[model samples]
Target: MSSQQQEKYEESELYRIRHSAAHIMAQAVMEMFEPGEAQIAIGPPIEDGFYYDFDLPRPLTPEDLVAIEKRMRQIIAGQHKFEKKAVSAEEAKAMFADQPYKIELIEGLETGGVDEYGEPLDEKPEISFYSHDAFTDLCRGPHVEHTGKINPSAIKLLHIAGAYWRGDEKRPMLQRIYGTAWKNKDELEAHLGRLEEAKKRDHRRLGKELDLFSVSPDVGSGLILWHPKGALVRHLAEEFCKDEHLANGYDFVYSPHIGRGQLWEKSGHLKWYQENMYSPLDIEGNEYYLKPMNCPFHIEIFKSRVRSYRDLPMRFAEWGTVYRYERSGVLHGLMRVRGFTQDDAHLFCREDQMPEEIDRVLDFCLHLLRGFGMNEFKAYLSTRDPQKSAGDTQRWDDATEALRAALDRVGLDYEVDEGGAAFYGPKIDLKMIDALGREWQLSTIQFDFNLPERFELIYIGEDGERRQPYMIHRALLGSMERFMGVLIEHYGGAFPLWLAPVQAIVIPIADRHIPYAEEVAARMEAAGLRVEVDARGDRMNAKIRDAQNQKIPFMLVVGDHEVENNVVAPRLRSEERLDALRVEDLIGRMQKDIEDRM
Candidate 1:
């Protein structure tokens, strides 16, 4: 598609609202500061919000946000008309004389207008500008017709942060203001409310409260310190993944954290993934690199043994932990980390086996996600970036067509990401929408024609000839850290009975009932449930509150009356169900829940 067509496609209703909101935000910032003091850099619309970078002597504060937001409301209330104008290169440069960023943008546009043959077109597309009242900005048109047409109550300032100009750290730092705009007042309110609830359910906050994990600045960024509780959860998740993979005919394998640099070279990772990889270290006169991906190692395992066609579809799975050098600024809590364990696997299959192997992986992925109680999903069929790709046309076509066929065969409707695939191959990414309506990328099934060819992977065909095998790389849980983050948010920290770090907490009202609480805990543990006894010398209400705060799914409150009747009061996290039940009966149900992995 043409660039203009791409722009048109990108401009959705929400995009227009956010784009117009950016202009309004810039106008607000300009008006809030003293007349010639405020210098604007760039204001762009992002997902669900608008942010503008600014150059100012004084750093903006919370109070400044309020003042600027107030001015924005005033502008919107004034109902100023937005006018669009087209001008020549000279006229555009003159209009943007004081705006360095705008001048740069216009110059780039002029250069783009030149033909490849070195002759500029006679009818060059004119530079466009949008004007609302006294504030004007160089922009492509398609904004709201009038400021008054916007819902005054539907826009809000979210936060302020420092960002480098054009995202380059070497450039001058600019203060960035973020805000969200919605179609209506109600939607805006709902969006803000969700944000607030999300904050309450943030895994980072819960991690601290529950003593789960922490990130220390002293330890460097993007490195996680998994506390005891967090480690227990991680262990459970990994075990669950291992069991699922085993049931799906996968052979478990272990690979080293670091491999010889030659291995990555053979797999083509050294060339394509060098930026994300750690610097190589020399060991005994040989250079070695930490593995960025587990695929190359698994492929080495496959190629170790000369395989007949019977072992063609060799499925190798591993909870391989690897490290990647993510941009420091992009790291946030455990969701984005430098070191993580990927539930990675690769199936070396013959050409004819690709479809069935992919189908099996998809089924296993669905079942695993369902086991974790994630039912809602969004699938993307990501194809090659046609403009910048290393593979030949035939291989790209074959890989992309294979993915298309799989999706079609399953009758799964997925959106196509025009150029979202990795440089190596086409892939399918599954993003699960949690109960909170947040999307998390959890599963990926990717095809790699480049790796097998680069590694010269081979399998004996039916005709007794050596032929290249197709490789499939799959990661059901993108990473343990991120998946745990999503799981915490999915269940709001009250994990399912089987997955909860502490499935049941036995609470004794007083010291007298502590013995009975121990008995109940023992019975629960015997039934294969994770149980803890709260024997603190605190009151019953305090203990109950503590359990609730920890988000324990069930709190078995034991007291004298319960001991007399040989029963316990089962209190749920929601406080909706508090019923007296026979201890054995509840134990039976808990055992069933654990056994079923529900």
Candidate 2:
């Protein structure tokens, strides 16, 4: 969300409704336990809905959720007026002394250092409590006038997940109940429908259904084992992008998986990024750590030799795999993995060529994503975080303005995320909006003046002086694993014709038609199509159904009539049957679609 939209959302009536709904839900849940059994933690209103954390007496279930939801509606119907009260530390402590979690939060509030969520506070806050009926919580008030203000029909209790207190894994585990609330039942239904569709399109479920990928526990969490079909789809996507890169003046480079500790220290990774990096490996009496980025190695290559103004603009690209340490709790299918390959590239250009290079890269990013039929996306310009950033004020400002200028020149609408940049520089992040309107961060064009200076990279200028070239780090597809995850969900496993693992499947009507099917498949394959021939003795309808389930683009049905006419009846996965056509004509039409990336 942009700053203006976020401000509007936070101040909107629906925001208050969700906030009050969370407190009401908390009241309903607190009633589930005895006087001092259930401990209440913090509850916050998030995008789309609200969630409340609780240290419950027992593990919750679906039945428990249903019961809690029922009680919530009752609480809402009670029409109790919400109230707030400011109290002293002693008074607050005495009110909920039995609740250990609330007491801890109260202590944080009393200290005037950290907020309720344990984040550092810029100034001391006036501690307050919000109460509706018998339950009250230590909170800053911005709730509805009364419980009756919330629509009962618009409210729902989603599900439960385990969350550590204050996001600290070592802290006590709490049950987080997620729920959504809208202005009306119609909106609620619409949201639920989208959620149902999302469930069906979930990458993990579809990945297994389509035999695309898997996360084997034996292979460790967050590690993807790409099956043949998934690997082929990735290969086709990468090959297409690689060809484009080569055509756009990018040269591929190879880098090792680990680097010396001193190299990382010099690059400032040891100081700013060591938390995400794995422990160093002891090799040849030197410390070598798994590379979490390919920038340093690419810089080393730049420093390998001297270059004049003629060689001022150099672009190095790589399908480099890097490793980072991710907690087991956050290890998602392919979306959030510990190890993945980045479609990484770095550009070293002199000051005079920087603006043109940025524009070209931005145009190329759009072209590449549009090839995958992803045209609905928003760009984000992340400025430097003062506390975390490494460069001087003037350098950071100039780099940020350059990226902003590029976005404006392209006429792409973008959001500026203040203090969200990487430690070393500013960046423009391209987030692709999927079919369901969820944004997936895919491409990034980062501007770094820090790395070139850190590595002491100098190129001879026209004035015969050693000058630091502007460096840009770019990744268009971010990572193969995550991009595949997004692509699988975006298309719902029915990829476009160009990127489909099996573009066409030839289904034989009977055992006698097997020879014709093989012949047709051979002809299509010879024309640069990924075709499969199903010669099983199964029924024709069964084969067609299987082909559709596999999400193939074309299902070529051949029998006596097609064999005699020397043609094929192409049935689309959409169930639309095209008229029978000669093998050459069918191949021509398919080739056109593939070329168009339809």
Candidate 3:
């Protein structure tokens, strides 16, 4: 979610309605168990809806959710006023003596440093309770005035999922009830429709159906194994982006997978990003670590020799694969993988050329994404945090302004996220909005002064004076794995003609037509199309249906009529058909589609 949208949601009336609904849900779930039999963990309103955690006597079933939801409606109809009460930690504990979870939360509040979620707080807060419908919960709430404020008809219980207490694995696993609450049934239906579409376009599901990629426990989690077709699509994407980078004055470079521990220490990754790094390897009695990023390696190349001012704006680009440890719980298909290749680049320019370099990089980022048919973007400018930043404050401020000015020059919609930058520098993050109106972070251009100082990078000017060079870091597509995942969902597995893994599939009408289908496929292959012949002996309609499911851009049907005319009848994935054409004419038409990137 965008920052503006988040702020709006937090203050909206719907947020309050959902908040109260969560409490109602908790009350209903607790009522399911006998007195003191069930334990309530936490219930909170989240984006789009709310969820509540519980340690029930037995695992919850769909039937139980239905019963709880039905009872919640009755409670809401009772119109119970939500009343709040403040109490001392001792009194709060005494009141919920049997509720061990609430007692633990009260102790945290009493300790004076953290909230109920175990996140740090600036100061101790007063313990409060909100009661309604004959049940009370420890909370700091902005709930609706009465239970009637919530439209029970607009609420739904989504599903049950297991969650660890306070996100700690060692803690007891609680059953979390996910649900959504809207103001009315119309809005609820629309949200549910979007969710249904999202499920259909889910990359993980599409990955299996399309035979694109897979993740196996035997191969380890968060590691993607790209099948032949998936690899071809990825290669075409990288090939196109690489050519663009070269045309834009970027020099491609390669770096090793592991580096000495001192390299990461100097880059501040060891100091700041150590948790994401794996345990070091001992090579020749020296500690070495997997490269979590390509920045340090690129910087080493910059310092390989003394550069001149004439070489001020040197752009180094790489399709470097890096690995970072991601927990098993968060390991998602392609989207949240541990091993991935980044479209990483670094720019070394003099101070005088920094602003222009920033502008060029932003323009280039858009150009690359647009090449993939992604046009909508939301830009976020993240400024440095005072407590965690390196380099001079003035330099940081100047770099931040440069980023802001670039965004302004481009007239792109953006938001300011204060004190959200990396410890090294201020950066501009570009998130591409997909077809479903979901934003995916794909491109970024960051200004870094810390790396140069840490690495002591310098260049000689015309005046024969050695001066430090300004460094700009960027990742156009972020990572190939995540980018492909977003692309798959954005297009819903029906890729554009140019990027389609199987551009065209040939379906023969009968066994006798198989020979001609192979001949037609060979002719199309000679014309530079990714073509394949389907001679599985299935009926013509089944072949067409299967081809459509595979998202093949074009399906060529060959039979006596087509072969006698020395042409192959072409059918598009959209079920649009065109007159049979000669092989040369077909090639021309398909070439036109590829040229337009349709």
Candidate 4:
């Protein structure tokens, strides 16, 4: 096969393997349950694995998973050949009469509707079934010729969880069996190892253990309550970003959390983004909404006064907090939240300055991300989706080329996402690869032509003609809550010296040394270090352990010898100890690290 053909064959193989694995798992599940006791729903191949949903008579347990997995291996060993046969919708319905979910799917296929998995057939296509031995399922197949082709040892069922049918809460809840299938056992083992490491570094667990944040039942779901330490870290991050923005020629701006319905309607947010927005609240006689984005507010700032070309490249920055409605099932700790503060900014520049501005913004994004220890970067240029976009074709092409040129000028690697742009215009999305080789999208520079036109925003040029300046929307850190969550997991809660909530802790060897430790902490604090003196009556080792648990970068141990000499024995979190150093010397070292953003 040619290279392209070979690539397609390999992809088809993996898809077939995963798709076949789901069927085998479903068959095993049916065998384990009593006749007519379990009804199989949709089984689909997703990223990294496959999952099959079933409406079981009872909740699945760990022991049940083991049993189902054992039976699946037995079925694989039987070496059943997969047989495909097309059937009319009427025949499919009759064949799956006992299975309500399958019957529902057949009905959808007959009526040219969407199935529970969201697979829609606008015009009814041929319905088919794939059968292996006595087990069969409605499907469109490109499956392995036989079950013997599967490597049973390379596949394992991971876990079982509750899922609502079609992802709708109102629908019947089903048991979803999540499993991973690989071409070989080694790859399976590697994937399992990554899962273990990911679990250990799970931000939700670290958040609670480190006392950084909490999501309480009383506070409602998808809402985060940053603890004191977490709040300090968040505030420090915002302060650093604000300082950077100011230095980069951005004017700080503020807007209310709620705006009148008319504001959203004028911005086209109500028409285009209403599904993600929260229901409007009625105040007096008008409707108000919790702002889902800060773009419209920044646009209002741009329109506050008419301007000549002198103010063409106006940058407005805000650490604006916004709210949106998220389904309960998808709300992860801080990674996905209902309310978050976006490091949002907008740049309005003349068309002549558009290319240069794009280049500058891309460079600035890389610089800011590097300061956070995210140096590896790649960008995706999302061009306008022809069917959904609103702007004229020429403007879209120009904006897309500007973004591409910006990436090329910076010598950055990028891929084009042909139709990934928002409805308004094209955009460039930057993804940062973290310490674990996981990619996180942290910055976006989007071009908008539709909004300015909708709002009738115009600036007078030197030629005395009203011209619509190109509007660029940028979010550097994406959102405070999500970024903090990523940061917590990125460093595994052992933040670098500059970003650690408590940079150092002073530990006294005894009660007599308490005053000296406090003095040491005071000196460090005066030097702008975040230091705390551990004054508890606990043993010295216990205090050190507590500081380590808190991931404090430096632990300053002050004994009589050190105190008398006005020095501290510095202990690093990595368990490295240094000889007694003068307080001034230690502070200077810390100051250097902070300056370097270590």
C-alpha TM-scores of all predictions: 0.86, 0.87, 0.86, 0.82
**Better candidate by lDDT, 1 or 3:** 3
Instruction: State which candidate has the highest TM-score.
Output: 2
lDDT of predicted model 4? 0.88
Candidate with better TM-score, 3 vs 4: 3
Clash count (model 4, backbone only): 0
Q: Order of all candidates by lDDT, from best down to worst?
A: 3, 2, 4, 1
lDDT of 2 by residue, 1-598 (tens): 7765677787988889999999999999889888888988989888889999999889999999999999999998999998989999889999888989888988887884788778888887888889998889888869899999999999999999999998998999999999999988998999999888888888889899999999878988888899999999999999999999999999999999999999999998999889999999999899999999999999999999998879968999999999998978777778889999999999999877887888899999989888887777788999988898775787688778878898999899999999999787899998865544567788999988678878998999999999888899999999999899888987999999999999999988988889999999999999999999998889999999899999999999999999999999999999999999999999999999988888
Clashes in predicted model 2: 0
lDDT of 3 by residue, 1-598 (tens): 7765677776788999999999999999988889899999888898889999999889999999999899999999999999999999999999999999999998888984678789778889989999997899999987899999989899999999999999999999999999999999899999999988888898888989999999888988999999988889899899999999999999999999999999999888898889999999999999999999999999999989989999879999999999999887887778789999999999999988988999899999888888888877788999989999988898898899999999999889999999999888899998865434567788888988788898998999889999988889999899999899988887899999999999999999999999988988898899889999999978999999999999999999988999899898999999999899887898889989998888
Model 2 is weakest, by summed lDDT over 10 consecutive residues, at 432-441
Clashing residue pairs, backbone N/CA/C < 3 A, model 1: none
C-alpha local distance difference test of each model? 0.84, 0.90, 0.91, 0.88
Model 4 TM-score (2 dp): 0.82
Q: How many residue pairs clash in each candidate?
A: 0, 0, 0, 0
Q: Given candidate 1, what's the lDDT at residue 35? A: 67
Order of quality (TM-score): 2, 1, 3, 4
